[model samples]
Target: MLFSLLQPALIMKISNIEDIPGHNIVEFYGIVQGSTIRAKHFGKDMLAGFKNIVGGELKGYTELLHESREEASKRMIQQATDLGANAVVNVRFSTSSVAQGAAEILAYGTAVKVVPHD
Candidate 1:
């Protein structure tokens, strides 16, 4: 996996806010985004149907969304890295139903280079 190949220190920072707190953004590399569509398998779908009738949380769907979000974030980070960004700011996520059983997860942010405030 890409994450496995990347050292922790080499991974770009990400934030939902416009700034990186103690750091200053010195360059803007435009917006970067990543997205993925996911759906449950037939067995999980059947289980989800049963859970819906029971009026409870669908664990399978929850896990699927979680994994999708992770993937989307990873892709977004990769794009930022490709642009030579050290951090991403103003990050945001959006979700939309792509089909009856599938949904798309999107991650976006402004890629930037940052330096510690002097």
Candidate 2:
């Protein structure tokens, strides 16, 4: 999978619910998403195999997953911001194995504009 670093132009508030506690959704911009797949490098794969035998945490795999999630989230936030959304609601994440050694991570949500309710 190919991925480039993406920095969100704005900090978009994200939530797992349809609405923010103190704000009301003024407009819905539809869905936004970002996804990426990652496979371990040969060196890391070897290291992980050894660690698996030793029964300890596989730091290389851990880092790969962490970075993948960050990239996916960033891309999602960027999309939402570009659509004039101040927030993304009903945010969700999913992971799947696309291949024997590759894993795909996805982040998605509904982009919406919200205003504080009085």
The global C-alpha lDDT for each of the candidates, from Candidate 1 onward, is 0.90, 0.87
Instruction: List ranges where model 1 is wrong by over 4 Å.
Output: 1-4, 8-10
lDDT of 2: 0.87
Error (Å) of candidate 1 at residue 42 is 1.0
Poorest lDDT segment (10 consecutive residues) of candidate 1: 2-11
Candidate 1 Cα lDDT to native: 0.90
- Superposition TM-score, candidate 1 onto the true structure: 0.92
Instruction: Go through the candidates in order and give the C-alpha RMSD of each one to the true structure.
Output: 1.8, 3.9
